[model samples]
Target: MVKIGIADTTFARFDMGKAAIDELKRNCSAQIVRYTVPGIKDLPVACKKLFDEQHCDIVMALGMPGSKPVDKTCAHEASMGIIICQLMTGRHIIEVFVHEDEAPDARELAALMEKRAREHALNVVKLMFKPKILEKEAGTGQRQGYEDVGPARI
Candidate 1:
């Protein structure tokens, strides 16, 4: 059976990991392992440990940065760390980050978190099982949370 790792942060007010796990369970028979940390900056190491210790095939790093400027900086740093981890592992680490400022209201923020997490979960399935599916959708402006922007006319 395939193994999937989920690395999430408690700093996020929403539970994006649950959404990803739910989506994964609904779609595939992969073994899912989750590691939770206290903040976004901790996600990279958590993911690396998941890959090294738990022997996950792929990982999803989920985080929600607050609306403050400092939070944006932290998010960017965390993103860079995740990228480095991916390169070091030579494996896919799907980064799902939802900034608190993306939505105007709490309800919308929560909704966006769930939508993005679930969509990325499906992407993981496609990547592992059906790469052709994603190849066909390339350049289609496939947004996860909000409506897809669609391909722009050249």
Candidate 2:
């Protein structure tokens, strides 16, 4: 399985990211791990933990643009954040920005992120993990496979 790590910087408690990951799980078999950071500045340590400990094959950041529009797009900001992650940890990264209002918008962003990952020569799978409020399945574990990968051997 492709080890994938997803980080969400948005204020929401990874709701959007969870949606996106669910969609990906249906189509692709990737080891998706989701994270939510308090803010943008706290991303480095978070990325370090994801990259170093998780041993993620791909690291993708999720940015959600709410109703009140921001000047810069989430994709743009995520790209910059990916750079910081790359520099800090010497690992290839991919970032996807999901426009939550419309489902099509999220799909469009996912495609773009995938293309960007390809351009960067990284075996990365990037997409928007949108969140949904569906009823949970009975007997299914709530927190499945969200464990840490331990330290990387030098």
Candidate 3:
């Protein structure tokens, strides 16, 4: 059976992870494996464990970077490690980050996180089983946290 690894951060809201898993369960048949860490910098190790130790087919690294340059730097480093892990394992690791500054308020941030995570869950399914869906979406620049700009509006 296919397994998906979810590597989330402890500092961020839990709703994002829950939303991703819920969407995955609603749309895919794969088993969901989750691992949470303290912060973005810690994601790499957790994601590594999921891929190497848990043998997941794909991994989703989810986190909410703080509204500070230092936090961005840490997220960047973690992203690099995730890339390295992907290269070593020969598997896909989807990086989903919702910076704390993305929204104006806590409620808005929560909504955006849910939307982004749910959208990414659909992407995971497409990457694993139905890539055509993503291809179709390309016509509109459809992606998580992105506003669709359909075909250049010609």
- Model 2 TM-score (2 dp): 0.50
lDDT of 1 by residue, 66-151 (tens): 99999999999999999999999999999999999999999999999999999999999999988999999999999999899999
Candidate 1: list runs displaced more than 4 Å: none
Model 1, position 13, has a per-residue lDDT of 75
Off by over 4 Å in 2: 10-14, 65-81, 88-90, 98-154
lDDT of each: 0.96, 0.52, 0.89
* Model 3 per-residue lDDT at 64: 93
Every candidate's CA RMSD: 0.6, 14.9, 1.5
**TM-score for each of the candidates:** 0.98, 0.50, 0.93
Cα lDDT of model 3 by residue, 1-154, tens digit: 9999999988996467888999999998999999988888888889889988898999999999999999889879988998998898899999999999999999989988988999888899999999987787777767587676557665
RMSD of model 3, in Å?
1.5
Model 2 global lDDT (CA atoms, 0 to 1): 0.52
For residues 42-97, could you state the per-residue lDDT of candidate 2 as single tens digits? 45556667888888766656554543455245445656766877887777555544
| Segments in model 3 whose C-alpha atoms lie over 4 Å from true places | none
The window of 10 residues in a row where model 2 has the poorest summed lDDT is 128-137
Better of 2 and 3 by lDDT: 3
- Model 3 is weakest, by summed lDDT over 10 consecutive residues, at 145-154
